[model samples]
Target chain A: MSLKKTRFKYLGESLIEGNIKITAILAIIAVFLIFFFILRESLPIFFNGEVQQEITFGKFFQGIQWQPVSDHPRFSLWPIIMGSLKVTMIALVFAVPVAIGAALYSSEFAGRRLKEFIKPVVELLAGIPSVVLGFFALIIMASFLKNIFGWTYRLNAVNAGIALGFAIIPAIYSLAEDALNAVPKSFREAALGLGATPWQTAVKVVLPAALPGVSAAVLFGMGRAVGETMVVLMAAGNAPLFSLNPLESTRTMTATIAAELGEVVFGSGHYHALFFIGLTLFTVTFVINLISWALFDGLMSKLYGAKK
Target chain B: MNSKGHLRKIKDRIKIGLTGSAVLLILAILAVILGTVIIGGYKSISWEFLTQPPKEGMTKGGIFPAIFGMVFSLLMMLIAVVPVGVATAVYLHEYARPDFILTKLIRGAVNNLAGVPSIVFGLFGLGFFIQFIGGSLDRSLGQSGLFGQPCILWASLTLALMNLPMIIVATEEALRAVPQAERAGALALGATKWQTIQNVVLPQAIPGILTGVVLVVSRGAGEVAPIMFTGAAYYLPYLPKLPTDQFMTLGYHIFVMTTQSPDIDATMPIAMGATLVLLALTFSLNIIAIIIRSRTRSQLRKGR
Candidate 1:
């Protein structure tokens, strides 16, 4: 009787364990499904003869227009790609210096109480919704920025990029702070003991040591800025113009997808074109994530000396 | 040597000044964003605006339907996501071997899922959920379009998927905080592993799990892109009574008012009102989660 009961108990345990394992595996399956379905929908454009004729590689890459809904559709992605790059560049220029500065201060200089206060205030910025930020940009910041810079367009890449910079600062600040904090305390002491002043030690000793993780943080922020949708959709004047000027109106890949996806007919060239943009976005972000992950792991091992 | 020391002091003062300004700039930005919303929207908000549906093409009316829809969608998302996320976290922390291939793959998936853009989730929801699953359901049930269209169910599920990594990461931290000695004690008393986990581990982990749920709720409530194509409507006369129904949401409502409203000047106030509410909801939820998380950390330290 005892042996039979023990067998039953063991079976129940294994059953429960198996169930948990399967549930965990579902996450992996979900990721695969997202990629698979996105790819499946996009594949039709390449394989279907009609879609291929309409949205050929030359038209998509070389043509200088994106008038997809017109009588004669041109699906060149050059303008949209330029728009995205311009906004991302502006956002990085605005965000990286301030974020790194704040991170350095919080990690290296702030008093205990001040650090505690600054940390949550910075995090609070992250909790604000992108839509809310977009609304602010649309109604207020665009006008505010236009007045300051005397821009021709109210909603241009600069306005959108500044808002995007606000959205991105928290991610960069938090990660960069973590990287700064992860440097061994002994390193700071060594620099100070060698007659280096606080600023000299921070810039010459600590910054170099933390550069890997900080770079990773910047890469993650770049990925975030590239993928953000609502802010650009609402703030960037959704004009698919091929321009490098930050003050000019332009559209991003995310904004284009958000604005057009709602109206496009399924299985149309426009639909496939949007998916193609998504695929490109997914690939870019995936590469960024992969590189950041490698750098992060290297930094961790460097700091913690490898985990068992 | 004295002159060099004086130069170092000047450099330190300049660096300090710069970093201080950086901190001040962030604080000022936060203040301006919040202040602008509050100053612009506070007057438009009234009890009537909170309770009544929009009238006059969203120019003059309350966003009751939007608020109701957002809450309902959050409830639906909470129901769908919490169980799956906790189970994943439990398996990772408690059941699976640390170095197993499966474990690493799941971890990678979770990390990658978090990196996917919110709009991509919107596309996946449209393709997979509304078109694929819902369409299949409609056909199998012999119903024409009951589930094949964008609705609250698909939107919530999509949001839940977007938030799953966050929940899993948070819950895993919580689960790892549980001491192994307690688990061993429960098992040494002849309790089965599952039983020990159920009775002893879960109780301790509930606060931490709640924190994760709160964070997910905060995130889901604020996200607009994933729902824009999935279920959120520009205008809905009535609140969503069924999962299959389309609904207006605060974030989407704000988006519509700012972008698509006919009377831009008239709609600005209402949009600001809605923005204020959405900000309040997300910020309060985030604060509650942060407080709970800090408390949990303190308790863990005390236990140690």
Candidate 2:
């Protein structure tokens, strides 16, 4: 009797549904597949005799460089990890305020025509591919920046970070704009009725209400910047240096995997090492994406739940 | 009280001005990037540049091979991604037994998949496609190295996986726009669940799914890192004619010319031209997608 209630009226319908169910799971499968395959290659470092001969867990911490090539190879991940952090920090510091501000202006102040124009402009910026941005940063921005302020190196974290900042601004702006726009129309009306000006309404009422989403937007941008490869590969002078100076040439985790994985022998220590870097990059971004999605979606339900 | 009110008003003015200036600065950056490429690359984008292959160490000639290769790979990517993406959307929307828990899990996976650093994907492609799966197939079939190598097929499949989330999200949005009442109406008229979806829901979702496809193509065309070791060649003397052949892509071409070129000065102009072409291709596709999406969204609102 229970089976009868769930039965399909047509015979092939259940079959089709089953097929679709199998297909749908491929997305989840693909995600796991990526982790599994990368892990499969990366595990050799910890277990393989040949890889362990040149590399050890302690060497990664003790050594301060990522010189994977030489008579003596060192796989200290400190330099690249720090390099990733420095470049990402500079990029976020440069991008977040401007993106949030533009979002605020668009949501609170701009007229319909200005608002329309601004959205498409940001989309156009988004559509300009990362490689093109990398090209600009390399040939145009590098020299142009050099002429403005004389620097020891033409390509450094500052140059790469700014270029990377350009790549992420659109993403942050879009998310922030959506967050700002999500506040109920009545909230603004109520704020204005209480004698608050438009600026005060935006800053005090709407912004606090949208805070979760706005920060989520910033988090999303941070994730994208951390994972981005070609921009830093082209713009940052690929020097794996352990320094806090934003003016120093740097290499990032993503860039390291991209640049080294190409030339490394197929089944050697270097190849396994590159996969290890890939695993860390994957884990960093997966955690960020998970947290951001929670924040981004939680705000929507909260806003709408409050409306009810 | 009057002076304090004045001070508050002044503070408000300053804050608003700051936000507006932020907008201006972003616009200025975009303008500068576009302006530099256009002004610098204009002389290099002639008919000969578009139709001929690179000559004399890529200082002269056009980007025909890169164009052909990119289109070929994208076509294969479209074939691989669309059905899986559409099925994922349909299963979430129509089936899955009202389990929000399962739905949320799928979405979380999809979103995380999108955010995975692309270089890791390049590594995954190399390890999974070129060595593990491809090697297994070759060994089983008694072949030497036909399948166990970097080729256009692997690169396109890798891109399809990278882009699956975007397609699923877009298709779901389109599915959401179709009113529940319409589905009920179809059911009330003796239509089965499968029949109702096939006859009513899917037809309306085609535009949205197309928007996703176009967006993915535009995106995949510009991506370089995922294809670097998977199948993208630095310089291919011949165009890739089969799934097994390596291909040259515009983004990789720009990357190689910028970094690996022995003669940077001579290669810069050619790279600039390729950048403009890629920019134009992606921008026009983006505009088309925007137009289609807005039109569909308006129709959905009007129907509601």
Candidate 3:
């Protein structure tokens, strides 16, 4: 009887373990599946004759037009790519300095109680939905910005960029603060003991030590600005124009995909074109994340002396 | 030497002022955003508005269906995600060898998955979940368009997938907090490894698991892009009656109303109203999660 019970228990345990393993493997499969399905759907744009006839590589890269639903459709990616770049650049301009400054203040200046209060409040900003931020930008910030700057376009790249900056700030601040805090206390003590002021120690010693992590934070922020959909979709005015003016309306790859994918017929060239846009976004963000990870690993080793 | 020292002191003061202002500016921005949403939306909320479906081209009436749909889909998402996430966490924390290549691969995948744009997740859901899996199911079952289109099930699954990383990370943190002595004691009592986890570790990790659930709920409630292509409808008169039926959600409702409404001026109030509800829901969930997490941390510190 004891032997039979023990055998049953072993069988049950093994079954449970197997089930858990399979469930865990699902996460890995999910990542592979996202890449696979996106790549598979986007392949027709490159190889399929009908899709290629509609949107060739030369026209896609060289053509200035982006009217994918026009009578003679043109699937140029330049204007859209430029638009994404413009907004992302503007977002970085607004977010990075502010984020780094706030992070430095919180880590090197604020008291313990103040740090606790400020960190959560800043994190609360992150919890706000992108759509909500987009709405605020559309209705409030656009007009407010127009009144302040007297820009030609009400809903322009600057409006979307500033709102997008709000979304990116928390990410950069949290990561940069973590990196700053991770610098050993001994380093700070040594700098101060060697007759450096608090400010000097922070800038000359700790900041340099945390440079890789801070740069990684900025890159992560850039990745977010590039991929953000609703803010640009609502506030960037959805104009696929190739202009460097921050006050002019523009479109992003993410905005283009969100706006066009809902209406495009399945299996059409236009559909494939949107998927192609998704693939571009996927690739860009993937590369950004990879670089950020490399920087993060470097920072880890610097702080810990070396890794295992 | 005195003049040089004075100049350095002045520059240091200026630097401190700049950084302090930056922190204040961020806080002020958060306050302004929340204030505008509240002031514009508070007057629009009514008993009838909360209980009825949208009317007259979505410019009038309540968001009951949207709220109902949001709740239903989130519940379904919780059911699907919690188990898979906890299992993955358990496998990583307790079962997998620390130096195993597969473990590292899985960790890398999870980190990358977190970075994928939410809109890309929408595309993945539309292509893989709705078209591929749902279409295959319909074909195999001899059903016409039964599961091959956007619906609650597909949306829930897509959200669960998008939220898997957050859940896995949170659960793993919680699992790591379980003391090694407890596991050892369970093992010494003739418990198998799986038994030790099930009876000894998980019981202590329940609060942590709840924290993960709360975080996922907060995030899932606010995400609009992932569901936009999967199952969210512009207007659904009746609540979803089946898993396959399209549903209205608060986040998507705000998106459509703000972007697609025929009368933009008329729809503003309704949009603000929806935004207010979404903000309240998400904020409450975050607060609850924060409280639970802090409590867990305090308990762990006490135990230590």
Better of 2 and 3 by lDDT: 3
Positional deviation of B112 in candidate 3, in angstroms? 1.0
Winner on TM-score (2 vs 3)? 3
Query: Which candidate number would show the highest DockQ if scored against the true structure?
Result: 1
Q: Which has the higher TM-score value, candidate number 1 or candidate number 2?
A: 1
Give candidate 3's whole-model lDDT. 0.90
CA lDDT of each prediction against the hidden true structure: 0.91, 0.90, 0.90
TM-score for candidate 2 (chain B) = 0.96
TM-score of each: 0.98, 0.96, 0.97
What is candidate 1's lDDT per residue for A1-308, written digit by digit as tens?
59999999899999999999998999999999999888888887778898887786667887688899998998989999999999998899999999999999988889988998898888789989999989999899999888987889999999999999999999999989998998888889999999888888888988899899999999999999999999999999999998788888889999999999999998888898898888888889889988988898799888887223
If both were scored by TM-score, which would come out higher, candidate 1 or candidate 3? 1
Interface RMSD of each: 1.0, 1.2, 1.1
Runs off by more than 4 Å, candidate 3: A306-308
Give the per-residue lDDT of model 3 (tens digit) for B114-204. Answer: 8999999999999999999999999999997889999999999999999999999999999999999999999998999988998999999
